[model samples]
Target chain A: MLARLARARTGGLAALVAVVALLPLALTNNYHYEVAIVVGLNAIVCVGLNLLIGYAGQISLGHAGFYGLGAYGSAILTVRYGWPPAAALVASTAGAAALAYLVGRPILKLRGHYLAMATLGMGIIISIVIATEDRVTGGPDGMAVAPFAVLGFTLAGERVWYWVIGAALALAVWLSLNLIDSPAGRALRALHGSEVAAQVAGVDPARYKVLAFVISAVFAAVAGSLTAYYAGFITPAKASFLHSIELVTMVVLGGLASTFGAVIGAAVLTTLPQVLTLLKDYEMMVFGAVLMLCMIYLPRGLVPTIADALARRRR
Target chain B: MSTFTLKHFTRAALAASLAFGAAAAMAQAPIKIGAFLSVTGPAAFLGDPEQKTLELYVERINAAGGVLGRKLQLVSYDSGGDAEKARTFAKRLIEQDAVDAIVGGSTTGETMAVVPLVEQAGVPFVSLAGAVVIIEPVKKWVFKTPHTDRMACEKIFVDMQARKISKIALISGSGGFDKSMRGQCLKVAPNYKIEVLADETYGGGDTDMTAQLTKIKNTAGVQAVLNAGFGQGPAIVTKNFRQIGLTVPLYQSHGVASKEFIKLAGPAAEGVRLPAAALLVAETLPDADPQKKVVVGYKRAYEERFKQDVSTFGGHAYDGLMLVVEAMKRAGTTDKAKVRDALEGIKGFMGTAGVVNMSPADHMGLDLTAFRMLEVKNGDWALVK
Candidate 1:
């Protein structure tokens, strides 16, 4: 059974790699590439977020705050202080991780809705600060981020960005999968199943919870930094409460505790809007309906429900 | 017999050549105008009408004989006020659609986000968003239709100077437009010999400004008050100003030039003044004014078609589409480079805003005269003159 589980993990990663590599064959234009890039970035964030919400069973409504911090941090560092894009991205991601570590300890102590509210408040505060600081972040008007470059080779065009985001996404998925199979991952699952029981079983719930929070925040931050550079602009809206809710929704919709499910959730939610653009004024109405139907029918989330069906069919 | 055969053959060849030439001319591809607007989000109020105006005019122009004998095609996407989405749509417009020009960016953030993309693509972009940053330093490929917050400040200051009111108090909201306008007013107050007595700001979601107003009211030698904001905040400020019974002149930025402001503020809005596009006062403008014909025509057509009150935001889009079309006409071809040159060389062209005089140095190409001063009277907008 353990060998089968290991095979399944490797199989999922290989399948994801194949999809990313083969997606370009079907993409005939830059628009397709652009949407794919956006999907990959969102998937990277959702992967990290899945580790916390899916594996550890921690709810965060302010993960977008970490994402926004990474975006604005890189934007300000590169645009204002003239730091190299690579250095700025690394520094911003580090900054967000440090912040998540500090806040995660106390915030993670609360259970259920209290934790959600705390994260929501943190996100709102970050959004307001970004909007208010017009001198630095350019406020709500947003500021341009310099093109992402490394070793004097600037990353330009949608095709180039597609490969960059694709590789990053694959790496993120690999890391999450590895983390899930480790002892720490088991401790997180134990905490999720029952915090009191987890403590009795010799797993430190507090440390593991904080660890999950910090890791998830690092994922969001790295994705956010990449987003700013890829789009060439950053706005306070990146950190808005609405965006946080959207990210959380992607994780839940993809199926909590399932790594591949998180990725599938990100892809569907990201591409749905682009497809619904054809509906024009009725786009929002239809989008809401689709989400409702999915929740009603596939309650276990998209991936888990389908996976369960396949197992039953084989039986 | 030989002479008859030669004559008949020459006539048939002439007819075939003529038909072929006409078919080639008729088959010319339409000029594609791309746009990305926040048509269904927080900024929908701005983008919805702008979208309507573009669709209305594009159809009208095609019916009245398309520019340079080719129909205009507008490919617009709803960005929903998301800057990242706006950038993505813009890329699609440029890279996939290969449009001749772009003419929409409903919010400053959206416009600013797409500026680099448009500039890099070398496509002419006429933004409908109101911000000095869109045009300041004059990006080569970018242009905007609405008057900047800085110009609005100058126009308001000029009106204050005319009234001999030098000491003014400013109460602004914390939104991007409010802050930018407040900053601009402070920057140019010295040029107009105006002194800012009190500068107060409220949060974006603040409902009550009574405390801020009372402080301004008690300030010594305050001749007028300017509220640099838009949305419900300005209307709330106007009501609060009246509730506090401050008799000083209340000036609002062009941000809230819509009739909704008057309706929201109720009877208290009666004496409030603002600088707005000529479209708002189309009926009140003198017949001799160059913009009177264009603004009145646009306002009537838009209202007749959409069955809604005409807005300056929509007028900005009208100006944007018309400018691009006019540039195409002047250039006499759909060549992107030539159309860009023609757009820059436009002078004395009457638009909803004013007489647009685009140049390499000034992409926006509207001066203080473009903004008309108006005050609320009998619960409607009245010409300030």
Candidate 2:
């Protein structure tokens, strides 16, 4: 069983890479490349978010706060102190992980909306601090971030960014899949199914929950760092409550406990607006209708519903 | 027989060539003007008018045999007052649509978000938002039409100086615009020799600012009070200021330069002062004034078409698009570089806002003279005389 699971995980990683590689071929212009890069960044964040929310039964309404911290941390370090971009990225991700560990330990003890409200407040407080601290964060106007570079090679243009973000997203999926197939992953899933049962079965719920929270926050932080470099600017809007809700919606809209579904969710939500924008004034209306229809017909989300149908047909 | 066939073939070839030339001239593409405004969010009041003004002017310009004899094509998107959306649309406008120039941005934050993209893309961006940072430490491609926060501060201080109100209080909303305005007021207060006795701030949605007002009311030697922000926040401050019975003359930033503010604040809006563009009081301007004709004409056309009172926010869009069109006319081509150069070279171009004179050193050529101090009287704007 372990060997087969390993083989399937490898297959999933390979499939993810193949899809990402083919995505740019469909893009004919610079704008498409730009949007595709955004999709990859959002997917990286959502994949990690799905790990906690889907597999561990944890809800984070303030994931954008971690994302913002990661972005602003890298930005302030590199722009102010002139730290190397790569070093800043690592340091910021570690910082976010540490923060999540501290906050998640206590917050994870709560269940349902109580957990949701705490996370929501956490995100708002981060946003307000970033906005109000004009001296460092450049206030609401936001400060510019240095272009991403490694060992004296500057990363430029949407085409280059697409590959970078794509690779990062693939890494995120691989990591999440591996984590899900491990002992800790099983522990999280057990807790999700029945906390009392899992606790009785010798699974330390608190330790695994905090570990999952740290991992998810690190994912968000990394994605945020990449976005800051790619967009050439950063703002407190990244940490706003609306952004946090959007991230949660992406995870829920995609099938729970599925690694690939998170990617699909991010890709669809990002690209849908760009495509529907051609509809002009009816853009939001159509977007809302599409979301409503998807939920109504495919309540289990796109991936799970389709997978369930395929399994039944095979039977 | 060979000579006759050769002659017929020559005639057919000439006719085909003429048809091709005619088709090519007829296909002279319209110059694309891209805009992204906050048309559907918290800042919708600003973007709605700005978008309408762009639409209204584009139709008018095309009707009058468009600039450089090519019809203007306005491609606009609603940013919804979000920076990420603004960046995406800014990129789309520049890269995908390949618009020759852009003339939109509703809030200071949205404009700032797109500044780097526009600068990097080398697209001439004429912002409709008011912020000193947009133009200062000047960017090569970005320009703005509205007066800066610094200029507004100077205008208010100059008015306060004339009234012999040596000591004043400052309370601002915590938004980006309010912060910058507050910063400018504090920065320039010492230069004007006016003392600020108290400084306080409230959130964008805070219902009551009485606590902040009460502090200012108790502060000694406080002769005037200035509230810096846009939307209902400023109105709430006004209501709270009056309710707390602070008799000091209340001042507001140009952010609330619309009648909606008066309606929101109701009777409390009475006697408040702020600096604004002459367009707000075009009908009252003397005939000898250069801005009178232009301002009045825009007011009539906009009100007749939209059935709403003209606003300075819309006037900013009007100025932005017209400036780009004028630059295009001067350049005589749709080339981005030439349009940008021509935009910088624009001198003394009279518009509804003010007599705009663009220079390399000064993107927003209007100084403190561009702002007119007005006091609210009987629920209406009256020029401060």
- TM-score for chain B of each model, two decimals: 0.91, 0.88
Candidate 2 chain A lDDT trough over 10 residues, lowest sum: A1-10
In model 1, residue pairs whose N, Cα or C atoms come closer than 3 Å (at least 3 residues apart or on different chains), thus clashing, are A54-A257
The CA lDDT at A26 in model 1 is 98
DockQ for candidate 2, please give it: 0.53
The share of true interface contacts that also appear in candidate 2 amounts to 0.64
Query: Which parts of model 2 are misplaced by more than 4 Å?
Result: A1-7, B1-27, B202-220, B236-248, B264-268
Error of 2 at B23 (Å): 11
- Angstrom error of the Cα, residue A6, model 2: value is 14
User: lDDT of all predictions, in order shown?
Assistant: 0.90, 0.88
What is candidate 2's CAPRI-style docking category based on DockQ?
Answer: medium
What lDDT tens digits, residue by residue, belong to model 1 across residues B1-385?
A: 9989899999997876577436474457678999999898788999999999999999999999888888889899999898989988998899888898999999999999999888877998999998888888789889999888888999999999999999999999988878999999999999999999999999888989999999999999999999999778999999999999999999998989888898899999998999998888899889988788898899899989989999988999999999999998899876778888999999988888888999999998999899999999999989987
* Error in Å for residue B24 of model 1: 3.7
Residue-level lDDT of model 1, residues A1-315, one tens digit each, is 222222399988888898999999999988889889999999999999999898888788999999999999999999999999999999999999998888888877766656677788889999989999899999988998899989989999889999999999999999999998899999999888998898899998779988998999999999999999998888888899999999999998988898888999999999998889888778899999999999999987888888877766767
lDDT digits (tens) for residues B12-116 of candidate 2:
978766774364653576789999999997789899999999999999999999988789999999988888889889989998888999999898888988998
